[model samples]
Target: MSKTYTNSSTKFSFALRLIVVYLLQLFIKAFDYSFGGVFPLTFRGMIFTFTFVTYWLTIWYASEYIQKKISHLNTISIVTINVLIGIYCGLSSTVIYMLGDTYLFQNGDLWEEIPFYNPELSVALCIIYLLIFTVYAYVQKIFQLKEKEVNVEQLEKEMFKSQYIALKAQIEPHFLFNSLSVLSSIVHTDQNLASEFIIKLSKTLRYIIEQNKRVLVSLEEELKVVEDYFFLLKTRFGEAIQLQNDIDPNVIETIMIPPASIQVLVENAVKHNKLSQKKPLCITIALKENLIIVTNNYDKKEAEEISTGMGLSNINKRYQLIAGKNIIIEKNQDTFKVSLPALSTIDHENFNH
Candidate 1:
């Protein structure tokens, strides 16, 4: 469908260009018979023809060039520009016509013989033709601008679709099953703890559901959800998993980051590394040099239990679409780190939807 539309648009544009090219010739031919026997088909007549067509094409495209540069278009501005071009084109065309006849054609005394040789009539015709051509140029510019807007909207829609798929991928079945299995075992022995577990589990699920709700979120809001997710993880893993948050409190309310970024990083770290009381998988989140840094100790597990491998990739995509920024990743034998650009509060409204 898009191809068909593009082909049709190309055909229309080609046909329109041909018509514009011939319109000036038509205008020149329309006045050719006015000279009759007084001005024959000679070098002088061809000179007038060249002058009219050249001047017409020059002003016509010049108006379009102006249209492209004017960021804001309105009736008054268009009218002002059109009137100026019309006057310039009309006065200059009349002078060119008179000069060509008086000097080149040696027909200065024949203006009375030629009915269409009146200067007022010549100027009026020039202004009228210019008005028509300039108006067409203005409308063509408007359509091009509208086409650009449509393309941008289509691009945004595609980005949002990717965001939805990424959000869905954040929910892990293994995490859910393991959390539920742990919950069932402790409900009787630790009723109070079980209740707390249920609450954190609900919050974790709710956080997943609310992903992609907005393009940007405050650090405070994102950390609260991350805390809920961490609570569930710690409750299940006991001393085997630990998270240390050292984000600057002063900027928590003022700085923004992509949603689910910290949670995804923490989840990714736990999935890829070994975790036990002997060597705990320690995850740290901190604000350093205007960056939200997530780091985890390296402990190679012979085999990872579950990894869709989309966690970090999805975070990178969301950050790009939301803030036009890229997340930085650095890893060595001892540690894996991801650095997310900290956004400002003033720009939150720019990415809300």
Candidate 2:
């Protein structure tokens, strides 16, 4: 709300500045005609200064009055008001100048007498002034439209950032809980295995924290984090969790993705299913054409059905927004597969490592 007020104030300030500059130009023109005239220019300067200032003040007041009275006025109404304002200002300036001449300069035997006031000239001046005002209003309207477009783009970027941060926050707690459970199970049986798990977990967490600040990470960096995550999962499940990858080296160097996206999909597969010696969890990561595919064999035990479905939904939303592509899901009776479009980048070898 305070920001809105500030913006409105800034807009008002801009309008005020424009008006001041316009008035200054009119004053300068008046001085050029009066003070820079043929003979001694004092009396003419005084009359012209008074006429110019009075005209500017009257136009400003009339415009403000019309705008306030018809705050929701249409374009036609505004133009009508402007035309009327131009006529009134021009006529008022002429009348004031004529009155000044009659009252003060009646001893008209000066070196050269000013010309008599002409009503036809005043009418022509009003028409010209109104035309200029109309053009100025049209230009102002164009600028206002451009300003609105900029504001809209800024707001959308802000909204995307906010939603991205919220989604990241949701996944972190879910990830931490699962990883800590795995660590707890391994602590008592194999101390060295538990230590190794801790190291891998630390690396994964570090990656998440560091990459959360960025919107994208190289595919290679993301794959490294996924490999560390796979180690932790493999440590927990032993031979029950089988993982394979067939990623293209060429694609890896030129593609980027949101950090932890693959990890989330893999984690979802583990969380929603059962892993045992007889029914192992087989997960495969492969790149086919322009798609990165993650597939897992479905073998959920009756007792273990703890799927929330948020991870896949979140990843889908992020991918759609970032890449302008849909995350495709293919499901059969025996397997579930997710295919994400690989996001291209400018640097060919940026993700080589």
Cα lDDT, all candidates? 0.73, 0.68
lDDT of 1: 0.73
- Listed in order, each prediction's TM-score against the native is 0.58, 0.49
For candidate 2, the per-residue lDDT at 19 reads: 69
lDDT of 2 at 55: 61
Please list all clashing residue pairs in model 1, or write none if there are none: none
Candidate 1 lDDT tens digits, 203-254: 7777666654566778998899889888888888999999999876777999
lDDT of 2 by residue, 1-353 (tens): 32474487567745764565355545444543434542334766655655565566566555756766876889798778777777776676566656665567673333134444446545655776676566655665775676555544543453355445434643567666867888888799889988988888788767755654555677888888889989988876789898888897666866787667888788778877888878899999999887899999986667764655666676665565455467899998899999987887732232212
Off by over 4 Å in 2: 1-192, 301-308, 347-353
Worst 10 residues of 1 by lDDT: 150-159
Top-scoring candidate (TM-score): 1
